[model samples]
Target: MMSGPAQKYVYTKLDQIKEGTVVNLYGVVKFFKVPYRSKGTDYCSTVTIMDQSNAKLTCTFFSGNQDTLPKIYSIGDIVRFHRIKITQFNSEFLGISSNGFSALVFEGTAGAPALPRTSSKTYSFTEEDHKIVESLRIWQMGQQTFSNLRLKLSDIKPEQYFNLICHLVGKAVLDKACYLLKVWDGSKCALPAWKVCVEEEALEGDADFLSLHQHLTVDVLVYDNHVEAAKSLKVGSYIVIQNLHAKLHNTCNENQAENSYLEFHLHGGTLYGRGITILPENDIDVQELQKVLTTVNLNEEPICSEDLTSHNRLSQKSPPFNALERCQQLSVTVLPTRQEWLTTPLSTVVKMKPPQKYRVRVRLRIFQPQHLYQSVKLHCTKCSSLQAVPDEERLDNILQGNYTNCPDTDAQNAYWYQSVKWKRNQENRTVTIHFMKKHDMLQIPQESLIMVEGGTFKEFCKLSRKFNSIIPVTCNQANLELDLSAPFLVQGNIWHYGCRNCSSLKSIEALSSLTLEGSWNATEIAKALGIKPLTYVFVMNLTLEDETGSLNAYLWRRAAEQFFQISASEIFMVNNLQEQLNVIMTTLCPPGKSIGEYPWMDCCIKSYHSCDGREEQNLYEIFDTLIS
Candidate 1:
C-alpha cells in the first residue's frame, strides 16, 4: 500500500480513469468471479464495480499476498480500493492489477456482526437504487464507434462483434453448461452464452423462468460478463447487450441454406480479447429504442400467431350487430328520381356537383331472375364445395343458433354471394351487388323499384357494400308509371316479324309498354320463350296488346312463373297441353279482369338491321321486361 498520510491516494471515477494511472475508487462490488489458475501456478480473479455515477470498471486480481480477494468481497458491498491501475482492452476501459500493494477495505464492516443475506443480489435492491438505474441513459447501438459496432439483427454479418438491444422472450434454455436466451426486436433470433453462473439456483427455481414459452430470434449472442448480467433478468425484460459474437454455420445443401438463420454466441474465452456487457431495461437508450419499436410495430401489419390470437379473442368478445339492428339504423335522404336516374348517364352521376350524396332510384328491367335470386350461396365449412345453402335460409339458421354446434368446421366460412345486374335501356351500364347479409339480399328482387340510401359516388361506382341500404320501394310511391301513348313504343302485329338483330333493337330510345288484352295459352307462350343460362327454367314470350298495336315482350323466369301461377318446369312437364294452357290463361288474364286492369309490362325494344347479303326487313326484339 503506497498510502502514507503525506502521499494520500487520489480517488477517480471509472470514466475518468486512464491507462497506467494509479488511483483509489470507492463503489459497490457489482460482481466478482472466483480465483482460477491462469497459465501455471498463476491464479487470477475478476470483479466489477459501479460508482455513484453508475460508471463501471472491471478489476482483475492476479497472484498476490491477498489471494482470497474474491472470497472476501461480495456483490453490493461498499468497498474502497487503494492504488488500482487502470487499463484498456478491446476499447473497454477497466482497472487491472488489484494485487500487490493495492489494498481492499470493506466499508462499515470493521466492528459489525454477520447478518442474514439473500442468495441473489436482486433481493437486496432498494426502490431508490431501482429509480436510479431506470433514470440512467443507455448507450444506443448507433452511438457505438467503429471499434465497437452496434447492429440490428437484419444488419448482422458473420464473425463480427456487435452490440444489440432486444426483449427477452422466454427463459434461458440450458444446454449442457451454456444458456440459450430467446430474444427478439420485431425480428427474432437466439442468444447463447457459456461460463455464466450468477443467480443460477434462483433462476432455476423461478416458475416463470422455467416455463418461458415465447420463441424469439437471436439478434446477438453475449457471453461471460454480459451473460452473467442477463441471467438475473426475467422474461419479457428489455436489455442492452454489448460485445456480442455473431457466428454463421456453413451448410452444403441449398435447402439447408434457405432454411438457415443467424445465431449469436457469447465468446467466453479470452481469444476475443474481452467479454460482453449488459444494461437493464431502465437504460435511457433502451427506453427510446422501445418507443421507436412500438411505433414501427403499430404501423406494420401483424402476421404473427400471437397477434392473430389476440385479434380473434377481441373479436369474439364483441360480436357485430345483428341484421335487424343494422336495418333500423339506416337513414334515407333525397335522391334522383327513377326517370332521372335512368336517363342520366353514369358519367353524369360521377361528375355531379360537390357534396352530392351517391344514391339514386331507377326502374331496372329484369331479364334474368337468376342474376338476383341465385346470387347468394352459402358454403359448408368442412368442404366448401361439398354443400351449399341459400343465403336467406342460412341467415335464419345462424340467428336461430342452429349452426352453434357446427361439426369440425368454422362457421365464418358461410358468406354471401355476389353478382351484377344491367339496366334495361342502358345495357352498357351495370351495377354489382353483394348479398353480404340476409337483409341486403332480401331487399333486392328482380324487376323491383329500389332506393339507394347513402354512399359515395366512388363507392357506388365500385358497388361497395359499405353503402347504407338499398331498400325496395313500391312502384306507386316511386312514381314510375309508364306513358302508354309514347311514340317510342315498338308497334307491330303479333304475327308480323322483322329480321333485325337483337343488338340493333336494344338501341331504340324508348320506354315500351304493353297491355295484356286477354288470357294467353301457357304452352304457346312457353314455346316462344328462351331458356336462361345456368337455370333450366323456360322464359315466356307474350304479345302484349293495346288499341294502337301489339308489341313483343318476354317474361323472365321469375316473372313468367308469377304470370302463369306455376313454375316453368311444372308447366313444361304437364302431359296435357290443354291443361297447361288453361293454367297459364287463367293466371295471365284472371277472370273478370280487363286489359287495362291487368299490370302493365314495361320493356325496352332491342333490334338489329339484317346484315346478310339478301335484303331483309329490320326485326325488333324486346330482350328484357319490367313489370309494374
Candidate 2:
C-alpha cells in the first residue's frame, strides 16, 4: 500500500487511491460510465466500487490520463486493479469529487486485473446510511453522503424526511413528495426516494414517463453533477440510492400534494450524471417470467352432468394462451380493465364510465358437432376486466383489486352486451352476446335455446343424452301441472294450437310471447316428413360417407329450416303407427332400396286385401313416392 506523509500524497485510505498509488482493494462494481466529449475527446471511464463491508469509493482518471479510458471496466464486473496511482480531480468543490481518480486499462493477458464472478445475493444498506436518513428528522442541518456513508448532502431542517420506507408502500396514490415511490424486489419492499423536479423519459415503447414495473430488475441512479442519471429508473429493477441530501423542511401541501414546497433538499443521485450498471441474474430468462404469469377461469359450473359445461375451458396453448384444436376465436378487450376494477373500491364505483357494447359474429365452417351460433349476455365487473387497459398502464394497475360492479347495465335498465365465441364443430360454431348488468329475474330466467345445427354421430349421441337428461327435467317443472285440472278451449281460437288438455295453452295468445319447450333432430324430422337423412351428416361423416349433394335435390336442401314443432308433453319416441311407419319408410330405408321395392306394398295390403305381385309392386311405388 502506498502511504505518504508528504505534499504530493494526501492523507486518505489506500482504497481511495485511483492513480499514483499502490493500493490493494476488493469490491463489486456498482456503476460504470465512460466519459466522452463532442470534440472526440474520450476520457477515462469511472466506476463506483464497494468493498467487502459495502463501503464505496469513486475511481476516476487524472487530467490528460487517456490510457485509463478504454474498455477495461464495466458495471457489475468485479476487478482487482493492482499497482495503480491515485490523485483527486481538480475542481472548485473539493470533498466529494476530490476523491475521483483512475487506473490503467487491464489487457487480456498481461497486467490484466482479476475479475470476480457475482452471485445472486443483493447488498443491503449499511448501518450508517440508515442512521443518516433517520438523523435528518432530529437535526435542522442538511448533510449528504457521496462516499459509502460520507455526508455529501445536507441542508435539511429538522424532521423533513420520512423516517422509514414502509410509510409509502401501499398508500393511496399521493401527489406530494416529489420522490414518492413504492418499489419491491420480489422479497423486500422499499420506497425509492425520487426528486419530483426532474422529468423522466418513458421506456422504449411506453408513454408513462415514470412507470417502473416492467423491467423487473433495475437500479435507481443518483448523481450530484448530472440530471440524466436520476431520470433513468425503470420497472422491475432493484436499486439502492445513497449519499444524496434530504430536504429538511419539505411538507406535502395540506390540500394538493403536487403543489408542496421543499424547505431543504439534496441533488438527485440520478442527476449525478452517472450511468448505472446492472448485473444479470440467473433467472432473467423469458421462461422464468412465464412461470410467474398465470391464467384465470371465470364462468358458471356445470348445471347438470350431461349439459355442456358453461363454456369451453381450453386456452390456446401457444406461447401465451393456446388451445388444442382450431375453433371459432375472437378477442375481447374491455374496461376499466379487469385489473383496474379490482383495485378500486365499491363506493368509488362512480369513477368507472358506463359499460361499452361490442358485437360478435360467428359462422359455421365445418359440420360435425351440432352447435348454436347466436347468443347475448352481460359481462361481469371484476379483476380480469380491468386488465384490458393498454400494456403500459396495465403494469401499475394489475394487482389493485377494486372489482365491485356489474359491467352490463345502466340505471334505467339499459344493457351493454358482451360477445362470446366457442367451438361446436369444425363446421358450425356458437356465438353468444353477454354483458355484466343487473338481471331481472321477474322478466326472464337464464333458460335460452340449445339448438344443434350440425353434429357428428358421436356429437349427436352426446347431445341426445344431454337434451334428454336435462331439458325435460327443467320443462317438467315449468309445465305439466297447469292443464290437467282445467280446460278452457271451447272453439276455433288460434290459441288451441297447444295441448288441448292444458289451460296454460290458452295463455299463449301470440307466438312472440310464448315461452314453449321444444326439441329438434335432423334424423327424427326426416323420418316423420319422408325426407332423406342427408342433412343429418356433417363434415365428419362427409369424409367417411364421401357423400355429395342431396337424395332429392329440390326438397332435401330446404329441410333444415323446416320445423318439426313439438309439444312440451310429447315423448321422444314415436307412439302411433303412422309416425312409426314414417320412420321406417323414409329414414330407415337404405339409400337405393326404395327404387327396387314394391311401390304400394304397405298401402295395397290395407286397401285391396290381396294383390298380384305386379299390382303389389305398382302400389308399393306409389306408397314409396308419397312418403319418400
Per-model TM-score versus the true fold: 0.27, 0.21
Residue 340 lDDT, candidate 1, scale 0-100: 21
lDDT of 1 at 256: 50
Q: Tell me the alpha-carbon RMSD of every candidate.
A: 38.5, 37.6
Count residue pairs with overlapping backbones in model 1: 15
Model 2 CA lDDT for position 269: 21
Candidate 1 Cα misplacement greater than 4 A, ranges:
1-82, 85-146, 186-216, 219-232, 240-242, 250-252, 255-257, 273-278, 296-301, 304-628
Whole-model Cα lDDT of every candidate shown, in order = 0.37, 0.24
Q: How many clashes does each candidate structure show, in the order listed?
A: 15, 101
Q: What is the C-alpha lDDT profile of model 1 across 16-35, one tens digit per residue? A: 77664778776555555534
